[model samples]
Target: MPCWFTLTCAVLSIFAFVCVLGSEVNVQRKNLLGLGSLQSVAVSGRLICLGRPAADVKVKLYESEVLLDSKLDEGRTDSNGVFRLSGSKREFTTIDPKLNVYHKCNYNGLCDKKFSIRILVDYVSSGSEAEKTFDIGTLNLANEYSGQTTDCIN
Candidate 1:
């Protein structure tokens, strides 16, 4: 083959190899963004009281029987009382997710005493998917409060 033809062939081969490698890298990136083999858990619900949505209620998740703040995931209900809390772990082991809700149903001006409701969810795992979403359903704060202790905010 002529020298010019040989050089052109080499350059084309290099370009094709680079294109394939770039596509593989893009796929790996998507997997890292929760589209691959990681395990995940999602908890979502609505806080309702007096037949209406309760907004600004503090919701938190913790490991069953563990109350350390460092391991807690927290969020507040939106204006429509809808909240979603999610977490993921690299391991495939199951986890017991607990939810603690704090709210003042019928009081005004940040009542000195807030009511709390604790929910102990069943053990859940992500299976073989990258992530799984679990819906805990709507929580009626007014009926479930039970006048529990007020340490949820602290």
Candidate 2:
């Protein structure tokens, strides 16, 4: 996949798309703005839709940005509904990471239901890789949470 698809632009007040594109569309240029060291994070969890395993659910790790969010890693759930992902980003300030979950769950809809869980700064480690892994435990996709939205594109 192209790098630009991973950079999800934040929704405006009217839910319109806004992207700041230049001649270059690589992630290295985005990191040049920061002289800080590399910070990393690792996460693992299982997803269950209704009462059964939710296989093939899309999961992404991102360092949230004002204009373009950097996608550290992206993958899908295994047959057992298990997923493990680790990624890093270099930033002058503390890296704000978020795990975006895109799943259909038990609903028959035109788009997948999207939800995000913010990784606390306490879990962020300064290095080329993460020293510790944060266990998100089992997530049941049967209930609605705040900031949840429908994503037609993932």
Candidate 3:
């Protein structure tokens, strides 16, 4: 074989290998973005009042002062006063997260007002590709509401 033909064949082989490798890498990246590297947040805690668990209370999670979608980002305390809220999104972004607890532990049904508590959670995400779980520990509802007073408190 001529020297030029041999060199051409070798170069073609390298080019083909590089193309195949590049395509494979692209496919793997797509798969990761589609299913593997999704960002999720899990928030869990317990509601307590007067040394007892407060059951059936509504728990809400907010990001940047906006309420998260209720269908997937809110929960109610169980019989043990434990609640868990989870949310997932495609892109990883830093969030200012807050927890709100609503219950009628203060007054009877006649008051038509419920006690509310707001907790500012320090969850500064590094914007990495990993699931995050925050255990906010137990929230005591026995104390006075420290959050802003709204018209709901009539």
Candidate 4:
């Protein structure tokens, strides 16, 4: 049908494939011991600039405007333009948090739309509590256009 629909279907197919083959992928981290209740979670992603990989960009994770974790030392991306951050994985019963990605607009002064994204974090358990790793993915960002201005002042 349409290009967007075709693209979406392709992406969904890829995701399905990954899910089916997920068990084949090996994890680098070892299982933790001496388990305890859930604590926090981890958030990670890559930053891009001008459709090119950007490095040394800070990604902040927050909980209702309150600073939870900051990746100052983890800063920057690699040649592949990928960055990652890890936090304590909490239980799903607990209230989840939202994370915000901030960056300068590469469009120069062409548009005022801020180049940023918001990701919702939820609990996805693996093995035991002690030997657990939070999984974060499916992050997609949308760009806002300043050209649209229709508001009733009244």
Candidate 5:
């Protein structure tokens, strides 16, 4: 009976130690700066296709002009034409950093339509993260047509 009591006490002490260790690990993760430190941000937008709500359209996100996080990382939109990208946010600002997205149609030589999406990048200052929405403003996305030029005889 004495041996059993000692073993039980030992087990309890181990469990307590594990709990304390877990709490410390969580604290460390939260302290990490940059994108990892961010919790989440709301990305809502309207699907624009032919100057209208292009329902079921895919949205994407980029970091430093390169693709980092995408709309697929979050989820798809609904019949209401609303989509969101939620995940660990990062500092994004005119002075903080820059992110760009390439509209698929704009890359092809056949399409001449301009497509653009809004990206919201959060900036962490001191201990708080501030949210900023980049409209990408107005863009005249052009299609690169690589072909021979035609000449007519007079």
Candidate 6:
């Protein structure tokens, strides 16, 4: 074969091998992190922004994993500023669950300001669905919360 053609073929082969190795490594990482058997959790809460209902706000439930966090469920607050969200993730170990509230309370900007709260690992149930709901009580978004951040993407 021509020298240039041989070099190009070898480079292509190496690239293909790298891609396959990367995929296998990713699978192994997830396996070690234990994101594989079903577990569920449920959360409920009310949000008030400036003494009014925090309507249409976004709320997301996430499984906090070592490799990559997984989004389980998402919902919006009702006219009364109430939300009930439940979701399940498959993990070989206990799942780390959290709730993310994306609201426009007390701010005028693009996307939404994010406030996150972690759910106790005890709340995670051993099944495909949650056995009970965990209420987080009411929150007044007018007051600033520590660890708040801005998230443009959901």
In candidate 3, how many Å is residue 142 off?
1.5
On TM-score, the candidate that comes out on top is 2
Span of ten consecutive residues with least summed lDDT in model 6 = 27-36
Give the alpha carbon lDDT tens digit for every residue of 94-150 in model 5: 322322222333234442232233343343122233354333332222333233122
* Model 4: colliding residue pairs: 32-131, 40-88, 40-89, 40-90, 41-87, 41-88, 41-89, 42-87, 56-76
- Candidate 2 regions off by >4 Å? 1-30
- lDDT scores of the candidates, listed in order: 0.63, 0.85, 0.61, 0.43, 0.41, 0.90
**Which order, best to worst by TM-score?**
2, 6, 1, 3, 4, 5
How big is the positional error of residue 142 in model 1, measured in Å on the Cα after superposition?
1.2
| Candidate 3 colliding pairs | none
Runs with alpha carbons beyond 4 Å of true place in candidate 4: 1-37, 65-74, 89-93, 107-121, 124-142, 145-154
Q: Tens digits of per-residue lDDT for model 1 on 33-77?
A: 756544445677898888899998887765443344323468989
> What is the alpha-carbon lDDT for the whole of candidate 3?
0.61
By TM-score, the better pick of 2 and 4 is 2
- Give the least accurate 10-residue stretch of model 5, judged by summed lDDT: 145-154
lDDT of 6 at 50: 83
Model 6 regions lying over 4 Å from their true place: 1-36
lDDT of 3 at 12: 100
Cα lDDT, model 2, residue 97: 89
lDDT of 6 by residue, 59-145 (tens): 999989777789999999999999999998766678899999998898999978998899997789988889988899999988887
Residue-level error in angstroms, candidate 5, position 68: 6.1
Model 1 stretches astray by more than 4 angstroms: 1-39, 65-72, 89-93, 107-123, 126-130, 145-147
For residues 1-154, write the lDDT of model 2, one tens digit per residue.
5555445433342244223334234445766876567899988899998879989999999999988899999999999899998999888689998899998887789999999999988889999788888788999987896899999988
Q: List the residue pairs that clash in candidate 5.
A: 47-54
